[model samples]
Target: MEAFADWLASSELGQYLLCREQAFFDRAVADAFGFRAVQLGLTEYDFLACNRIPWHGYAGPEASADVVCDAAFLPFDSRSLDLLVLPHALDFTSQPHQVLREAERVLMPEGRLVLTGFNPLSLWGSCRLLRGRRDAPWGGNFFAPTRIRDWMTLLQLEPTATAFMAYSPPFSRGDWLSRWQFMDNLGERGWSLLAGVYGIEAVKRQRGMRLIMPAWKPVKAGSGLAVAGGNERHPVKQSVQDEISHG
Candidate 1:
């Protein structure tokens, strides 16, 4: 699994999928604004090339990466990153929920998170199951889109859009792949949830309510009329009572 990046970089099927994903990712994250952006897991693809972020880093497991670390244990301060892109990381990780929680921890409030995964309800997934081969991605665990959506919701990540890509079945030949390209249109409209791969964009949200307090002071009774001596049994009132008694 360590050389999986190199294997994928040179595979014919991988090349085809990369071409399809490049455009989809560019559109999904090109206009995103951020000071720093990260591409995790798939190191060969620069999916954030069109993004406007100043700093972009790529990381992979047991591979040459700008920052070599685990996705579940990101080495960044809390709320430091503006954007994050996980290129099929969750689908290929042992702990998908932990990776998501880490991403949410590093992202600033309202920061955008873009990620992709292999859809288990698609032809490519069926092929993976039939092959029963131990490879980088095929060996990885594929997840359903709805399941991922539920995970995102639990992490307080608000899903903005979910796009289906690579509608064509996994084919090595250009002619056969081109023939099946019509599925892109039909799959996008009707069979969207059954796409081979899916990319979801979500925004991190902080849910704490703001606290407001009003100023308060001790209240004294009869303070306003204390100077007038209206009903305090004062010496002046006592002298008036004595004169009334004498009369």
Candidate 2:
């Protein structure tokens, strides 16, 4: 995982994919308003930079993370965060389904979840097959978009938006990548599923009746209801601090 992080920060191909993913995240997170937002991994880059959420932070098993912890066992309370971003975190982790389960556990009802993953049905997947599982990304598990959506469905996360990007074939050299840049526009129009990466935005849903509370009634803290207003210290933050201190 550390090798993959270094590759994303330094390699030419990594930089290209990062630029494309950044653009997608910038648009995906712009409209997701909330009190607390947490990005699960890729701590080196700020994927939540475009979010309007007042209190946002990173949590992962990295020294640079605001709260160092495993993605599959997040310290946050159930239904605590309003928005969560996972940038290629699932692809790298061995417990991808458990990580998704953890993601569902931490998000509040109606909270938004955004994730990006490499598509196995794309040109990039073909390149990975040719590489014989030799490196950081190629060796990582590549899941199809439909499979990810199916997993999200079982977790009651309704898909709101989905997009495919990085249509160009995987090339190590910058000049080769630039020459194939036109494929991006063409791929979006003709063969979207064959794109290198896919991004998904989903909202958590709750079953049963939702009663409207009277304005005069006192609202309890950590009630698992969405709160909007000035930034305040949330219970999730406290849990994060405790986890860090105890560790």
95: Cα error in model 1, Å:
1.0
The candidate that achieves the highest TM-score relative to the unseen native structure: 2
Which ranges of candidate 2 are over 4 A from the true structure? 210-247
Residue lDDT tens for model 2, 1-247: 6677888888888899999999999999999987999998889899999999999989998889999999889999999999999998789889999999999999999999999999989999999988877787887789998899999999999898899999998998999999999999898897896799999999999876889977897657773332235245444455565666699
Q: After superposition, how far is residue 90 of candidate 1 from its true place, in Å?
A: 0.6
RMSD of candidates 1 onward, in order: 7.1, 19.2
Pick out the ten consecutive residues of candidate 2 with the lowest summed lDDT.
223-232
**Which regions of candidate 1 deviate over 4 angstroms?**
1-4, 210-247
